[model samples]
Target chain A: MSIGIIGAGQLGRMMALAGYPLGLRFTFLDKSKDTPGAQVGDIVLGDFMQAEDIRRLAGEVELLTYDVENVPVQALREAAGDTPVHPAPAILEAAQDRLDEKQAFARHGIETAPYRPVDSKEALETAIEALGMPAVLKRRRLGYDGRGQHFIRAAADIETAWEALKGAPLILEGFVDFDREVSLIGVRNRSGETAFYPLSENSHEDGILRLSVAPAGQPALQSEAETQLKALMEDHGYAGILTVEYFEKDGRLIANEMAPRVHNSGHWTIEGAATSQFENHLRGILDLPLGSTRPRGHAAMINCLGRMPALEPVIRFADTHYHDYGKSPRPRRKLGHITVVRDDRASLDAVITELMPLIKAAEGGE
Target chain B: MSIGIIGAGQLGRMMALAGYPLGLRFTFLDKSKDTPGAQVGDIVLGDFMQAEDIRRLAGEVELLTYDVENVPVQALREAAGDTPVHPAPAILEAAQDRLDEKQAFARHGIETAPYRPVDSKEALETAIEALGMPAVLKRRRLGYDGRGQHFIRAAADIETAWEALKGAPLILEGFVDFDREVSLIGVRNRSGETAFYPLSENSHEDGILRLSVAPAGQPALQSEAETQLKALMEDHGYAGILTVEYFEKDGRLIANEMAPRVHNSGHWTIEGAATSQFENHLRGILDLPLGSTRPRGHAAMINCLGRMPALEPVIRFADTHYHDYGKSPRPRRKLGHITVVRDDRASLDAVITELMPLIKAAEGGE
Candidate 1:
């Protein structure tokens, strides 16, 4: 009767909010007794590595999925047993490692920046030679946002960059001449039926997602993104939501990374689309027929990082929607997001103009 | 931190659903441990009169509200202490008694069917003498749908009607030659700022509400309904949602009853309006600026009484939205509802024609 989620974050909380109206029950497996998801649904407090806890959660629900990509893939597989674990642990495993993610993309004929594994100083030197200057060095696993990446400009900067990221298995990724950052999300069901939402043009500040505009640019770019996404979904046999973030350069989509679960860029779908990504993800996992993925209007989503802004001005806008994650305010953590949706382009732009400054001030930004 | 609701039925369940994305927490007090609201938020199982349980819930939340009119008014007043209770217990008490509700409407210059108190068989005879034959006899408190009414069509029927309802104080009222049944829901914040949703034309079967069409009929009727609603809200010193059901005959509005909390007919506002009645109720209690009350599209809501239909066909529609209140199916009980919203009248009518039969079958209709 209930759906179990591995991580109790904003995405899990939103999924519960969407699923509740459909008679779907929700229970979360979270490490913390108090979490954003716990505020909305039932929580089973335990670590992801606890096999007993994972199995206990699986036994209580009809199916399993996750909010975060950092979960232990094998534990999910082991716990799922005869039950369905959507988007599959294999997909999570591929998304967990940067080297494997890029390699998987290449195998699926999706373009990616050239990269090579770097373990020792000799391997790093060889990779630098092959990838060229201004290459980025990153830890292969447990990396998020910009936490694990260091840019190497020249040979002199190598030692310091290596000292900063040494101990973990690393990958050197060559920099691409990208014009803009965009993300495409597609959902697939167990029956092989697939639905894709609009492409989201994204902006990140200090490696944290700051803004996303839905139906990014125009139709042609979105079509190409969909083509690449469908290929990835078919190749992996994904059964829930999958998102691929791309760097658009000279009208070409070069894959930067893919999240096996829902992405932050699709938050606008809650108010902008006819059916939200969260509900579609549940529908896909449940193997129900998917809903329409069409956008109702133009949407601009701004993340509320570090602190929650007062909601008075935001709700005053005709079609604006505010979502708070109910997490404690931190220096750089994402606290919430506000989405402004409008049937016309002008109202959308007007709200975006008025909101950016307010959100920026809340985040202690310049 | 959290909003405490007294009755954990579908209404409280929905309030929690709407409030969660706004970073609101919810806790409920209900007699039943297994309630629809318990699936979404914390539930404190206790009777409404249990002061200890009510006090504990009040202690845990920022404010309190109720989903049903059946809760003990004095207990809520006792538990609220200094913490705000929206739509005030006074309004709840007024809504509880049919006589008082009609009197309040009359005080606000809203016309109602002619009525008189009937405490005894002698009083009932005198009331029928003034109101005429085919008058209706109703108990003053704790009645819903058509449960507490009996018709006095002839002299022979008077003894039977009196025998059935003589113990309780009753009201004998003349019937209105109404052309249609419509309801208007208006919300007022503590600041006295008011917003009204368009009138909803409703259809009832066997005294239980069956269907509601939003943005009902013409603008003139909606305006008159809004005017009467504003007067009632102002007279009650009300905050939060209030709904007034009306009988429209000869282009005149006659108030039948008023609900101090969110009403069933306004359920379409969840998906049809830019902002839902649940969210606005929370905003009113918290004194936040209300969201837009404009309709996003035309909406039709059909109640799924006693059973739930298969969800596959419902979600397959591009604009259909399904809600299941996780209660066990029972004969003649209010179960769940489905709302379908569309941008045009043709599609709205098309969906209404498509859904009525399916919902009727699910409810085990005759």
Candidate 2:
């Protein structure tokens, strides 16, 4: 009767909040008692990678899932005997490694930035020569949100980039000349049914997402993204939400990465879509029929980084929805976010213009 | 920093769910630990009348409110030394007693059913003589959803009605010949700013609310309800949401009763209005700016009683939102509710027609 989660972060907290309305119970496996999910549910504090903890959690609940992709995949397989782990753990393995993810995309005929593995200093030198200059050298494992990455510009910069990333299993990649960055959320069920929310135009600064605008409405761009995502879902036999990030270049969508869970980019769907990604994820994993994925209207979500905003006045804005993560504020931390949805594009644009400054002010900017 | 509610029923649970997105915390006081609110927040298990418990809760939270109106008023006043209670304890006193409620309406020149207090069998006899042959006699307090009252249809039925009602103070009233029953939700904050959600036509079965259709949209009918509610809110210096039920007869709005909390009729606003009543109540109680209460086109909410409905299929309905109370189902107990919202009237009506029988089947009706 209870849905068990491997991580009890804010996403799990939101999943619990969304699930409670449909009469679902929740228990979370978290190493710390201080997580957001622990604030609202039953939690077992233990390391997610520990086999004993995963077995203990599975013994308590029959269905298992993870909010974050950092869980140990082998430990998940041990727990997947009597309990089914949605997203299948293999998807997590693929998504967690940069090279494996790119290989999967390549095999599926999906275009990605050209990349070659670099396991040693000699291999790094060979990959740089093969891929050319002004590329990015990244750790293949455990990298997220621009962390564990170094930019290789000219020949002079290769030594510094190597010095920064040579300690880990690395990949050297070509740079993308992208016009804009966008992402699409697709959900599939056990019955092989699928639904896709509209494409969202995303803007990031310093590798942190700053804003997301839904239904970026370029039909051709969205259709192309959908085709690629549908094939990827079927390839993995995935049963839940999958978010694929893309770079729009020459009016074509090139796949960059995919997340095997409900994503921050889809947060606008809570108010903008008829069925939110969180709800659909639960429904999909439970094998329930997927709800409608249609966008209600134009919506924009602005992330509050570093600190809680001066939200007292911000909430007064019409059609604005605000959420605070309840985590202690720290520099560059995702403290909270707000969404503004409207029936018209002009009204939505006006609100976005008015809100971005407030968001910036909250982040200690001019 | 947090809102303290005197009772931890499902309403408090819903209030917490609504408030969490706005960066608010909640603590609840309830007699049972098994209630829905206990599942989500800090709860104190004690009687609402226990002064020590009340003092303990007040010590922790400076802003106090209640979900259910039946809390001990004097205890609430005792708890209000440094804390402020929204809608005030006096409004609760007025709303609790039928005689006082009628008197308040009369003082404001509001039209209500013709009535007189019946303290004894002699008083009942006199009231029947003065009022008419067909009348309803109701107890003064602690009665809801038709729990109290007996109908006196003829002279021969007087003794039995008096015998059934003689145990407590009562009121004899002439029932209105109404065309339809409708309720309006009006919220006012500390700054005297007021906003009203559109009138909702409500249908009740056995005096329990069954359905509410938002924006009944007869301008003349709505203006009258708004005028009377504004007078009542100003009269009491009320802060928070108040739901006033009215009867529309001969195109004239007749006052029936009012509740001093976020009400069942307004639950449709969670996804159908620009602002939900739970959020507006928090805003009003915190002296924050009230959000817009404009209905988004049309909405209908169906209350599920007695048993849990088969909702996996129901959730797939487009634009339909469901909430289960997370309580064990009991006969005649309100287990949960569903709301169907749309941007057009015909679509809403169509869903309502399609859903009503399913709801009735869930309630063991059809």
Report the number of the highest-DockQ candidate: 1
Under CAPRI classification, how is model 2 graded? medium
Ten contiguous residues minimizing lDDT sum, candidate 1 chain B: B357-366
lDDT by residue (A76-158, candidate 2, tens digit) is 89865788889889999999999899988888898998888998878888888888877899998888878998888898888
Would you list the C-alpha lDDT of every candidate in the order shown?
A: 0.88, 0.86
Against the true two-chain complex, what DockQ does each candidate achieve? 0.78, 0.75
For candidate 1, give fnat to 2 decimals: 0.83
Q: Chain B TM-score of model 2, please?
A: 0.97
The whole-model C-alpha lDDT of candidate 2 against the native structure comes to 0.86
